[model samples]
Target: MSANEVFLVAMLIIFSLPWLVWRLCRTDYFAPLVVVQIVMGILLGPGVLGRWFPDYHAWVFAPPVVQALNGLALWAVMLFVMIAGTELDLGQAWRHRRESGITAGLALGVPLLLGCAAAGVLLHLPGWVGEAAQGWQFVLGIGMACAVTALPILILLMEKLQLLRQPLGQRILRYASLDDIAVWGLLALILMDWNRVGRQALFLAGFALAAWGFRRLMVRLPEADRWHVALIWLALCGFTADWAGLHYMVGAFLAGAVLEAAWFDQARLDQLRHHVLLVLMPVFFLSTGLRTGWSVGGGEVFAAAALLLGATVAGKLLGVHLAGRVLGWPACEAPIIGWLLQTKALIMIIFANILLDRQIITSASFTALLLMAVASTMLTTPMVAPRLANRRAP
Candidate 1:
């Protein structure tokens, strides 16, 4: 087959298979289409498809095809991350500062400590830490991965659960928004290249000045022009950050973070997000899947995934429950919030992807983190639905 034909074949598989499984199997109750796409990506990856059908896998995912897909995935994820950042309501968080601070703090901190301990255990073993990573970087990266809350995914889940506009849902958003900031902040720290520190510093200084000018210009332009300018901003920031060795994803997040959400029409912004997910993000998922490997042994990878999953679940619940006590919330509220906040699909995978790209974690470790993310996301709806149902039973 021609290279273009093979690439089309790969694209067909990426989009069609996941939808078929998601729609035909009625998995939405437990696993949404996005989650299924992720799982399908894993199933189609080298560990599964390549193992089961080597020649076919190689032919379909040829170097040129894979390269084309990667280019799409990179831009897709950058747009998605920028949208996530633009939606961050830091002002809302500030309005509820005391509660937001305490909840976000514990929500992120507890899992971080537990995940660090889990990484520490992996450190004693072989094939977990990447070649380029120091012990601290490996441990801290894993810790933050476990602690992450996929704010975008969380919003989707809440919307599905019919709680998005509810008071509780808004509160959850506030907490998740603050954690999103910290998660990216930590990622920047982890990706810091001491050798390129001067470049990074200059990037930051230049970005600050540019961002101020950008904001001034944005408010004056019509909303239609803002969208176009935002993309230009995204491209420039992504390029500069990658050049500075901070990773383009960090810059992508910053590009959106500085822009006020109110500047754009909410409905249009939401539609753009929906369209991106529908059109582009499936490619990103498949690319992520292609990167998964079990070189450390499948059993070992699964074990690590299970360990991270346990720490993530337990720590999130513990932290939220502690917050409930301090805030004098009702007993039932903690579990629902905890379960919802623990959703970790796209953001965690993105976090782990950056780690793997920089060799801060091995493919074996990335595989494990990927598994943990899928499990955590799948658990969110099942765990929260019952609690919500019971609460509304009376």
Candidate 2:
């Protein structure tokens, strides 16, 4: 809105981008780009001085600035998600599909079901109040949130550890990626239900068909001309989707899925990824870091926050374990898949923001849920997949 506000926002990005890149370039260990940006965000936010200097935070990470920075980040995120969707090869797992399907179902369905039940129980706790905080509402939201499997994180870590090329890595990544897409579809459905709109499902189905049709048409276009205006179209779609009551993410994500280069065109896909990953995605992750107000923690809020954290971790472990056995996830693959699919990331930030927006969940609850998500992701995803591979091997 004002020149000073605009200047502060730019400074945040300028500081964060290089900090993360430097960390990522120096060593692959502690600092992949996302983790670095997250750290940068913490240092820059209320977590540190925003904690120490309350007035500085109020003056700096203002509501308008947060919105503006996050808005800039959205495109990069959509690009990343789209690249993820496009990279999926249903055929890779088609042979193993039957077994992997069982593993994936346990990974997805079990967590989802259990997450809901966990929420139901948690919400009824005495004196708890929330937006979508009632029995069924709470249950369903937690279940799906617990069910979330972070595909991008999985791929990033796998690549970093050189696990992507391994058999276990391949099986896990392929299955996780496909299942991630499926889960997003389910999330979209939950949103439709949340909005009390039955027609959105049909609208999405039609959107899928249209994407397929457009993708088919794009293949016939001259190579350079095909991708030239793709980002423009996607941004336009994102704005339209947001205005239409469906989250901008639905359109943004689906646009990525639709425009993605298919299986045979690996080179083009790789080139496309270079642009989205190094450029856009970092912006998105950094923006997310900036948007989170770590300084908002309060006393009563912490207990509820703690409950959310506990529920999140316990829900995923139990949910995934239950489905792992029932779906016949090869004992090794099942537990591993359970952990992999259970990791949550920025999605919780969105959910927490939704609660915050409605004044349902306290700022502390938002902080706690986000912490739960990050902690769960860091703890579960990094170690579980590789270890499972070792155990499963003959």
> Which candidate leads in lDDT?
1
Model 1 lDDT, full chain set: 0.96
Give TM-scores for every candidate, taking all chains together and pairing residue i with residue i: 0.99, 0.77
Off by over 4 Å in 1: none
Tell me the whole-model lDDT of each prediction, alpha carbons only: 0.96, 0.60
Q: Provide the RMSD of all predictions against the true structure, rounded to 1 decimal.
A: 0.7, 4.4
* lDDT (Cα, tens digit) per residue for candidate 2, span 285-310: 55555544534345544554455556
Q: For model 2, name the residue pairs that clash.
A: 46-50, 115-143, 116-139, 116-143
Q: How many clashes in each candidate?
A: 0, 4
> Positional deviation of 20 in candidate 2, in angstroms?
6.9
lDDT string for model 1 (1-394, tens) is: 8999999999999999999999999999989999999999999999999999999999999999999999999999999999999999998999999999999999999999999999999999999999999999999999999999998899899999999999999999999999999989999999999999999999999999999999999999999999999999999999999999999999999999988999999999999999999999999999999999999899999999999999999999999999999999999999999999989999999999999999999999999999999999999999999899998798
